[model samples]
Target: MLSIAMSTLRERWVAFVVSLVALALGVGIIATIALVMNSALTGFPGQRAALTGTVVLLSVSAGVTGFATVFIVASTFALTVIQRTRELALFRLIGATPQQVRRMIVIEALLLAAIGCVAGVVISLVGAPVLASVLASSGLAPSWFEVSISPVPLVLVCLGGMGLTALSVSVASRRAATIRPTQSLRESAGDPPGARPGRSARTGWGVALLLISLMGMGVVAAVLPELATVPVVYLWVLLTLVAAVALLAPALVLPVLRLLTLPWARGGSAIGTLVRENTLTMARRTAATTLPILITAGMSISLLGALETIGHAQSVEAGERLRADYVLVPEGGPAISAEALDRARKIPGVRIAPLAPTTVQVTGEAGLADGFWGYATDAQRFAAMTSLPLIDGTLEDFGPGGIVVSDIWELGAGQRVTVTPDGGKPVQLTVAAVVGDSAGGGDFYLDVSDTGPRPAEAAYVQAGGEAAAALRERSGELGASLLTKAEWAATVGNSDQGTGVIGMLVTLGIAIVYSCIAIVNTMVMAATARRRDLTLLRLLGATSRQAVAALLAESVVIAAAAMVLATAASAINFAGLLAALTQVVPGATLAVPWAPVLAFAATSALLAILATTLTATAAVRTPAPLSE
Candidate 1:
C-alpha cells in the first residue's frame, strides 16, 4: 500500500501539489497563532488585562484559519478522489478490496500531510517573529513582546494537521471505495451518475445548520444584544451559514448556473450551451469550485459589513445624542488644562461639561477584581450637554458620592457598589442612574469630587448667538481644537472602528489566501480531468481556440454563480446582524462593503478563468489516441 501510494503521488504530483501547499500554509498559520497565544498566556505575568486582548485576537485568527484549512483540504481531497475514479476502478478489477482502496487513499493523504506539516513548522520559525512584531506595532501586544517557541505547540499542530487530513480524506475515500469497477469505467466515458444517496444527507444537514444559525441570531438579538457587535459571534453565525451553503452547493449550484446562463442558452450561443451542459453534468465539480468563493467572498462581506454597519450606527447614535454646539479637544496633549476650561467657561452664554477619564477596580461576585473604565464630570452639566438615555433613576440624583453606570452593570437605582479608584481607597457609592450603552461612553461615571483632581479629557459645549464664535476663538488661543458635532461624530466613527476593522482584516487574511489557492487548485484539477472531453471536442471538429473559449466561459459561469450565491448568503447574515443592532442602536442602517466584496469577487473570477484557460489550452494542444 505504501509503495502504491508513493507511486501514485509521483504520477499525479501536479494534482496533489496544490493540496500540499494549501495544507502547509494552513498549518503554518495555525502553528504561528498557537505560539503567539501561548506566549501571551505565559509571558505576560500580572498583566492579564493587557494580554487578554492579544489572546482573543490570536484565538479568533486560529478559528478562522482552522476552518479554512479543513474546508479547503476536504474539498481538494474529494476532487482528487473523483478525478481518480477510473484508476480506483482498475485497482478493484485487479482484486483490490474496498478496504484496501480506502487504506491506500488514507495513506496517500497521511504522506502528503506529514511533509506539509514539517514544511509548515519550518515556515513558522521564520514567520513567528515577524508576526509578533506586527502585533506589537499594532498595539495589540506589548512593545516588549517576543515569540516564545516551544516544541510542544509545534508537535501538537503537526499531529492535529495529520488528524484533520485523515478525517477529510476518509470521507472522500468512502465514496471512492464504493465505486463499482464497471460503473466507474462507463461513467468515465461521459455518462455520469444522476444523483448520489449522499445528496439528501447533505441537503438535510444544510437545512439543519441554517436553522440553527437563524436561532442563534434570534437569541443574540432578543437576549444578548450586547454580543451583536462582537466579531466572534458574527463569525460563528457567518461560518454556519457558509457551511450550510457549501453542503447544499451541489443541489443549488446547477439551478443558479442555469438561471444565469438562461439568456445565453436561449440566444443559441454554442459556448453558452456548452457551459450550461458542462456545469449541469459536472455539478459536483462546479460546487467544489464554487465553495471557496462562497466562503471567501461571503465571509468577508458579511463580517466587514457588520462591522461597518455597527460603526455607522454608533456614530449616528452618538451624533443624535449630543446636544453640543462644539466639542473641545486638547491640541497637543492628552487632556485639556484647567486654565483652558476656565477660558472656555468665560465665553458668554457657553455651557461646558468637562469629562475626565478614570478607571475603577470592581470586586465581582467571584471576588475577582475587574477594571471598569469611567469618566468624572458634573452630572448636571453633562446631562445638559448630552441626551443620555436613562434606563433607571435620574441624572439629577447623580451628586456627591453617587455613580452613574452603563446598563452593562447589574446595579440599578440606589444600589451601593464598591469601587477602588486608581490611586485611592475603596469606597462605596450609590448607583444614581443607569444609562443605555453608547459608543465612546465609558462603563460608568463618577462625581467630579469623588475622582480627585484630573484634567478634563474633552468637553462638550453649548453656545448660542455669538458665544459659539467667541468660544471657537478662545479655544484656539488655549491651544485646543474645536470641532462641530458632525465632525466629532465622523471622527468618532472613523477612529473607534479602526482597531476592530484591523483585527477583522487580520483574521480574514488567511481565509482569503486559502480561498485563492483552493480556487486555483480546484479549477486546475477540474481542467486536467476534462482533457478527454477537450480531446473529444477537437475530434468533433471544434477548434482548440473554440474549446478553450468554452472552458473559460464555463469558468466564468461558475465564478458568477458562486458570487451570486455568496451575495445572497451575506444578505441573510446582514439582516440578522441588523436585527440585533436595532435593539442596541435605534434606526441602525446597513453599510455594505461594496468595494472589498466586489474586488474579491473579481479577483477570484479572474483566477478561475486563467487557471481553466491555461490548463485546458495545454490539454487541447496534446494529441491523444481515442479511448477504446
Candidate 2:
C-alpha cells in the first residue's frame, strides 16, 4: 500500500504541489506568531511597564493567526484529497480493500506533512528577524530587543502542524472509504467529505458552548468580579463564539445564497440565471472558498472592534474628566515647581490648579493596585477647575484630612483608607467624596496640604483673552508647555489610538494575504473541477461570455456568503464582549469600527471575484473536447 501510495504521488505530484505550499505557508505563519509571542512574554521592556495591556493584545493576535492557519491548511488538504477521487475509485475497482485505500491516502498525506513541516520550520527561522524588525519599528518592542530562536516553540509548532495535517487528512479520507467504485468514476468528486454527518450535532455543540460561555461570564461577573477582567477568560469566550460560527456557517450558507440570488432567479438575463443556478448547485465549492474569508473577516473585525471601543472609551473618559481650557505639562523631565504654579496664578485672568501625580501602594483593605494612582492638588482650585462628577459627598468637603476616590475604589463617602507613598510612611485619610472613573485612575485625590507640597506633574488652567497669551509666553519660565483643551485631549488619546491602529493593520495584513491565497487556491481548483461541465455548456450553445459570467457569479455568491457569516460571527463576539465589559467597567459602551468592517467585506468580495474570474478565463479558452 505504501509503495502504491508513492507511485500514485509520483503521478499526481502537480495536483499535490498546491497543497504542499499551502501547508508550508500556513505552518510557517503559525510558527512565526508563536515565536513572536514567546519573545514578547519573556522580554517585555522594563522602562514602560505598567500592565499596559499590550501583552493581552499580542496574545490575541497570535491566537487568531494560529486559528486562521489551521483552517486554511485543513481546507487545502480536503481539496487535495477530493481531487484524488478518481484514483481512489480506480483502486477500489481493482479489488483493493477499503482499509488499504485509507492507508494509501494516509501515507501520501503523512509524506506531504513531513516535507511541508521542514519547509515551514525553515521559513519561520528566516522570517524571525523581519518579524522582530517590524515589531521594533512599531514600538511594540524595545530597540535593544532581538529575536531569540527557541527550540521548544519550534519543535512544538512542528508537532502541532503534523497533528493538524493528520486530523484533516483523516476526515477527508472518509470520502475515499465510503465512495462506491462506479460513483467516483462518474461524479465530479469536487465536494468535500463529511457534509452529511449530524450537522445538528455540530449546531448543538455550538449553541451549547455559546450558552455556557455567556452563563459562565454572568456567574463570574456576579460572584467574582476580579476574574471578569482577565484576558484569557475573555479570549476563551471569544474562541467559543468563533467556533460556533464555523460550525454554523455550513448550515447557513445555502439559505443565504438562495436569498441573495432571488432577484436573478425571479426575472433576470439568461446568463445571470444560469450563473445563479450553477452557484446554488455547487454549494460545497462555494463554502470551501468562503470559509477562509469568514475566518479572516470575523477575527479582524472582532479584534479591531474591541480595541477601538477601548480606545474610544478612554478618549471619552479623558475629555470628560476635566473642564480646563488649557493644560500645562513640563517639557523636560522635571516636575512643575511651586514657583511656576504661583507665577501662573499671578498671571492676569488665569485660574490655575496644579496637580501632583504619583503611584502609591494601599496599606489597608483597599490597598490594591486597581486604584493606586494618587494625585495631590488644592482642594478648592481642583474642584473649581475640573469636572469630577461626585458619586457621593462634595468635592468642597475635601480638606487636609480628606481624600477623593474614583468609583473603582468602591469606597463610600467618609470611609478611611491607608496608603503608602514612595519613600514615605503610611498615612490614614478619610474619603471626602467618590467620583466617576476617568482614563488614568483619577482615584485617590488628596489635598496638597495633607500630602505636603509635592512637585506638580500637570496644571489645569482656565484663562482667556490676554491671560492665555501670558500663560503661553511664561510657559518657558514655568518649565512647561501649554496646550489647549483640544490638544490636551488629543495628546491623551493619540497613544492608545496609535497602538490600536498598528495592531489592527498587522492583523489585517496577515488575514488579507492568507485569505487571498486561499481564495485563489479554492477558485482555481474549483474551476478545474467543473471544467467538463463548463466545456459541455460551451458545446451546447453557451457563449464564452455566458460561461465567464457564471464563474463570476459563483465567486460573488461565495464572497457574499463569507461576508454574511463574518458579520454574524463579529456581531456575536462584540455583543458578548460588551456585555462582559459593562459588568466589569462602569462606563463600557458598544462602539463598532464600521470603516474597517466595510473595508474587509469589500476587499474579500473583490479578491474572490477577481480570482475566480481569472481562473475561469483560462477555462473558457480551453477547447471543449480538451477540457475532459
Q: Which candidate should be chosen as best, given TM-score against the real structure?
A: 1
At residue 21, candidate 2 shows an lDDT of 79
* Top-lDDT candidate index: 1
> TM-score per candidate, in order?
0.89, 0.77
In the order shown, the candidates' Cα RMSDs to the true structure are: 3.4, 5.2
**How do the residues 521-561 of candidate 2 rate in per-residue lDDT, one tens digit apiece?**
76677676666767867888988878787778777877777
Per-residue accuracy of model 1 over 1-628 as CA lDDT, tens digit each? 9999999999889889877987898898899888888888887688766677678878888888888787788878877877777788888988889999999999999999999999999988888888899988876677888889988889999999999898778667887778677754574433256654236555787889989988988988888766776665567877788777777777788789879999987999887888888777767667777777777777777777877887787788879888888888788655798778877888779888888878899999999998898898877788767877789999888877999999888889999999998778888999989987554578998877787767787888888869888887777778788889998887665442214667777777767877787788888888887888888888888999998888888888888898888888888888888888888788789987789867887888889899999999898888655663
Clashes of each: 0, 1
Candidate 1 global TM-score: 0.89
Candidate 2 stretches with Cα past 4 Å from truth are 1-9, 40-55, 85-110, 166-182, 188-201, 209-240, 268-270, 328-467, 473-483, 486-494, 497-501, 573-594, 622-628
